[model samples]
Target: PAASKNTIRVNSPRVRCDSASAEKKKIMCTEAEIEQKRLAALAKRRQREQEQQQQQKKR
Candidate 1:
C-alpha cells in the first residue's frame, strides 16, 4: 500500500528508524529570532523611558 493522506502506510516490510526526523529536533531559528526581537523591544522601551525622564527633569 502507498502512503495515504489519511493514514501512513510504510511500504517497506522492515521498520526503519526515523533518524532524519525534523520533528524530534528542536527548531533553533524561531527561538533566536524571538530573542533578538525581545532585546530590540527592551532597548526601545528603555530609550523611550530615558528620554521621557530627561524631559521631565528639564521641565
Candidate 2:
C-alpha cells in the first residue's frame, strides 16, 4: 500500500531499512533499554531545538 505524505510506506527501501534496524517485532523495551532510548531521543530533540534556534538566529 502506498502512503500519504504524513506516513511511511512499509515497503519503501528507506523505511524498510529503518524499521528492520530499529525493531524486530518487539513492542516492550526493557527498563534499561527504555531509559536509554528515552535519553537518546531527548538528546536528539535537544539537538534539533539547537539547530532550529541557530536557524532562527540566522534569519
Candidate 3:
C-alpha cells in the first residue's frame, strides 16, 4: 500500500508539470509569431522610405 501510494503521488505531479509546460510552450509560440510579424512590418516600412528618398533625389 505504501509503494502504491508513493507511485500515485509522483505520477500526479508529473502529469501536472507536463500540462504546465505545454501551456507555456503554446504561449511562447504565439509570442514568437507576433515578433516575426512585427519585424517583417518594420522591414517593409524601412524599404518604402528608402525608395521614396531615392525618388525625391531624382527630381
**Best-fitting candidate, scored by lDDT:** 3
Candidate 2: TM-score?
Answer: 0.50
Ten-residue region with minimum lDDT total, candidate 2? 1-10
lDDT of 1 by residue, 1-59 (tens): 34473254453322344443443444566777888999999999999999999999999
Query: TM-score winner among the candidates?
Result: 3
Question: Each model's C-alpha lDDT?
Answer: 0.70, 0.77, 1.00
**TM-score leaderboard ranking:** 3, 1, 2
Q: After superposition, how far is residue 29 of candidate 2 from its true place, in Å?
A: 8.4
Which parts of model 2 are misplaced by more than 4 Å?
Answer: 1-29
| Candidate 3 C-alpha lDDT tens digits along 1-59 | 99999999999999999999999999999999999999999999999999999999998
TM-score of each: 0.57, 0.50, 0.94
Could you tell me which residue pairs clash in candidate 2? none
* Better-scoring candidate (TM-score), 1 or 2: 1
Rank by lDDT, descending? 3, 2, 1
